[model samples]
Target chain A: MGQYIHLIFPLVIGWGFAFAVIALSHFLGPKKNLKTDLTPYECGVEVVDLPSSKNRFDIRFYLVAILFLVFDLEVIFLFPFAYIFKSVATVSPFLMIEMGVFIAILLVGLFYVWKKDVLIW
Target chain B: MFGWIYIALCSLLVMFAILMVSARRPISSAVFLVLTLIGIGVLYLMMNAPLVATLQWLVYAGAIMVLFVFVVMLFQLRELNPTSISTHPGRFALLLLLGGGFLGLCLKGVIVGLQEQPVIMMGQTLVTGEASLKDFSLLLFSKHVFAFELLSVVLLATLVGAILLARRKQRVS
Candidate 1:
C-alpha cells in the first residue's frame, strides 16, 4: 500500500489541472447576458424540428456497442498473457499455442461478422 | 491511514450504489453505476493489484459503462415514473429473504475466518508484484488454458448472437 501511495500524486495533479483550467475559463472568458445567445440553437437560426427525447435509436448503434464491449474484453484477457509471455514461454512449449488458439477462436467471430456485412456501416 | 482511506472509499461506493438504484432517470443511474465501478477499481488498487485495478477501470468503468449508457439511450425512457415499476409484494418478500440469507452466510464466513487465523496472507504479504502476476499467468496458461480458450469461444458466441439479432434483413432478389 505504501509503495502505491505515489500513484495518488498523479490523481491530485490531474484533478488540480482540470479545476484550474475550468476556473480560468470561467473567470477570463468574456460574458454577455443576451437572451438571443441563451437560445438552444444559436447562429441567428430559429430552432428547427427538435428531435424528441422519446425517439428510439437504431439497433445498429447497440450492435456496434456490443461488438466494442466484446473486443474490449478480449484486450483485457490478452493483457495478462502478454505480461508473463517471456517467463511462461521458457517454462512451457505450449504457451504460444494457447494464445494462438484463444485469438483464433475470436478471429472466427470477426470473420463471421465481416461476412455478414456487420462492419460495413 | 490506508484503513481510513479504505473506509472512506467504501462509504463513497455505497452512496453511489444507492444513488444508482434509486435515481429517477436511467441515464443518471448509469452514471452513478460508473462512479461505483470506479470506486471498486480504486479498492482493487488499494489491494496492491495494479493489473487487476487497471483491468477493472478499463473493462468495467470504461467499456462496460459505455455499453450500459448505450443501452439506456437505446430505449425511449426519458421520464421514469416511480409508480410505473410493478411491484409484487410476495416476490419482493421472497427476494428479500433470499438476499438476507446470502448476506448472513457471507458474514458468518467472515466471522469464522477471523476467529480461525488460517495460513493466509492478510495485510502486507498481500502485496501483488510482478512475481505474483507471473504465477497467475503461468497457471492461466498452463492449468487454465482450456478455460481461457473457452472464454474466446464464449466471446465469439456473443458476437455472432449480436449480429444475428441486430443485422438488417435483406429482401429476396
Candidate 2:
C-alpha cells in the first residue's frame, strides 16, 4: 500500500493541479458570448448543422491509430531488448529470429494498410 | 529546500496542463500534453524510480496519449466552448474543499513516513542503474514472466480489434 501510494502520488498531484488551473481560468478569464464562437468551426467554414453533425468518420482515421499502436508496442518490446541485448545475444541466437518474426508481422500489416490506400490523405 | 523545487516543478506542470486543455487547436493541446507528461516523468525520476519513469514514458506518453492525439486529429472535434461549461458555484467550492483536505492528509502521511525512515536518499545502486540491466531482464523473465506474456496477449488482441474496427463493410449496391 505504501509503495502504491508513492507511485500514485505524483499522478494525483498532476491531475489536481490541472483541474484547479482550468477551474481558476474559468473564474478569472473574460466572459464572452457569441453564436459564432459557440458554433463548431470546420476548417474555417461555418458548420452546416446548428447543433453538430454526428457523421461517421472515415476508417482511415482508425487505421492510422492502429498503425501507431502497432509501432508503439514494438517500441515497448524494444526497450527491454536494448537493456539486455548483450546478455541475450550471448544466451540465444534464437532471440534475433523471434524479433525478426515479430517485425515481419508488423511489416505484413503495414503492407496491407498500404494496399488499401489507408495511408493516403 | 527540495520542497521549493518540488513546488516550482508542480507549478510549471500545472501551467502547461492548463494551456493544453484550453488550447483551441487539438494538435497544440496534444503537444502541450506531451510536455506535461515529460514533466511528470521527470518528477518520477526525482522520486528515484527510473523504472517507473521509463514505463511512464513508454506506456502513457508513448502509447495511450499518442492514441488520444491521433483520435483527436482524425475526428477533428471543434474546440470546446469555455463559457458553455455549466458553472455551479457551490459545487466548485465543495470540490475545492475536498481537494484541499485530501492534499492535507497526503502531506501529513508523507511527513510521518519521512520522519520514521529519515528518508534515506539511495544513490544509484547496482539494481537501479544501467549495470543492473541483466539482472532486470532476468527478474522480468523469471518473476514477471506472466505479466510479460499477458502484455503480449493484450497487444495481439488490440491489433486484431483495431483491424476489425477499421475494416470497411461493403455495401450491396
Query: Best by lDDT, which number?
Result: 1
- Per-residue lDDT value at B35 in model 1: 90
Local accuracy of candidate 2 as per-residue lDDT tens digits, A11-50: 8999999999999999998988877788777877876664
TM-score of each: 0.78, 0.54
DockQ-based class of model 2: incorrect
Error of 2 at B131 (Å): 3.2
C-alpha lDDT values of all predictions: 0.76, 0.65
lDDT of 2 by residue, B1-173 (tens): 23434555666677677667656677778988998898798777666567667788877788778788878866777766653222334544554554455466547655755666444333423345554556666666557756765665566566666767776675312
The candidate that wins on DockQ is 1
For residue B34, what is the lDDT in candidate 2? Answer: 90
Count: clashes, candidate 1: 0
lDDT, model 1, position A98 = 81
- Candidate 1 lDDT over residue span B1-173, tens digit each: 34445655665576667667767788988999999898798898877777788888998989988988988877856756663322334544554554455455546655665666554423465544777777777787778877888889899989988887886778213
